[model samples]
Target: MRKLVIAISMLAFAGSAAFADPILDRQALMKERGKIVGGLAKVAKGEDPFDAAAVLTQLQALQANAEKLDVDALFPAGSDAGDTTAGPKIWEDMAGFKATEDKYLADVKAATAAAPGDVDALKGQINTLGGDCGTCHQTYRVKKG
Candidate 1:
């Protein structure tokens, strides 16, 4: 029926509009980045066996995720509202925020190129990567309860 079609169209538009919010988009991307780091962390912590290929795969995925992050677009002016945990420093010091992002990407690319073959190597790589993540989070993220 025409009414059914209209209702379905409205629902689809509503769903898409919800996802179109930049806050939601950046949060989703950050969640995915966390998952990739978590996967690598398991191996680094020895909770998971170190498989060279698997570690490389995760590193590559991390690179892709970092590369996909467009901080300017994702964290545009006036997008600091809603459920976001972004710190005020991010907007106040946009240049510093972007520099951190660039550093993270560079570290990921270097680690990927290095391609750790053993647990020790992977641990070192993870440490550097984790440090980069921590620095950014400490400076640019707000803790929410």
Candidate 2:
């Protein structure tokens, strides 16, 4: 099931890449990331049944997602004009933005390596990952109602 999910995700990403609309592509990627995080959060908060394998699967998915991110291509020079929540800061400080993205990828990699076997451990991993997400969102994302 994990393999199937990964395969399907890969296919979807590949299919999406052909279109090459950075704004929409980036939005889709972030949405998938959010969904993955939300699933993990449900388990961490005891809202969903904790399955060690499922947790690992989600972590692996996050790792795969992070591994495939091409931030430069995703947020090109002219993409800021469209329907996006990406802040101007992303373009102004591209290096800083990439650094933050790198930190997020690192955090996700570490959590996946830790492979939290239970809910308590999963909560810690989720907290760390969530902090990384919040850090990027707070700095790089424009909040819109």
Candidate 3:
């Protein structure tokens, strides 16, 4: 009976790991992006000292993440069945989702090019980048509790 219970627990664990793999991967990606965005926001809000070099690094990281984001693969058919905040519209309206992703990438590219030299300039670029994030989230993401 103990052996049987152990086998069942192992099987359950394996099943859960398989189910959560994609969601965990996507969550990690989003968390990295969030950290970069949070730093940018702090600088923009004057909560942190404006370091141009750091801003450039963060922008570069953001741009790279945007480029690396593979929406289709990252968001597979059953990937959203877990604890994801992604809305059903992402899969339902794939074209629109792709368009929103493209817009965000474009905004990040533009912000990277702008490379704000000071806090004031950074604020404007942050606003543009943040707007892209806002628009995409509002349309494609569901708020989680």
TM-scores of all predicted structures: 0.86, 0.89, 0.82
Q: Pairing residues by index, what is the TM-score of model 3? A: 0.82
Write candidate 1's Cα lDDT for 25-119 as tens digits: 88988999999999999998999999999899999999988987888778999888888999989999999999999999999999999999898
Q: Alpha carbon lDDT of residue 52, candidate 1?
A: 93
Model 3 Cα lDDT, one tens digit per residue, 1-145? 9999999999688646542466786777788898999999999999999988899999999998888677876788887687889899988998998998899899899989889999999998888878888987999899988
CA lDDT scores, all candidates in order: 0.90, 0.90, 0.86
Write down the worst ten-residue block by lDDT for model 3: 14-23
Off by over 4 Å in 1: 1-19
By TM-score, highest first, what's the ranking? 2, 1, 3
Positional deviation of residue 113's Cα in model 3 after best superposition, in angstroms? 1.5
Root-mean-square deviation of every model: 7.0, 3.3, 9.7
Where is the poorest 10-residue window by lDDT in model 2?
Answer: 13-22
Please give the distance, in angstroms, between residue 86's alpha carbon in candidate 2 and its true position after superposition.
Answer: 0.4
Off by over 4 Å in 3: 1-20
TM-score of 1: 0.86
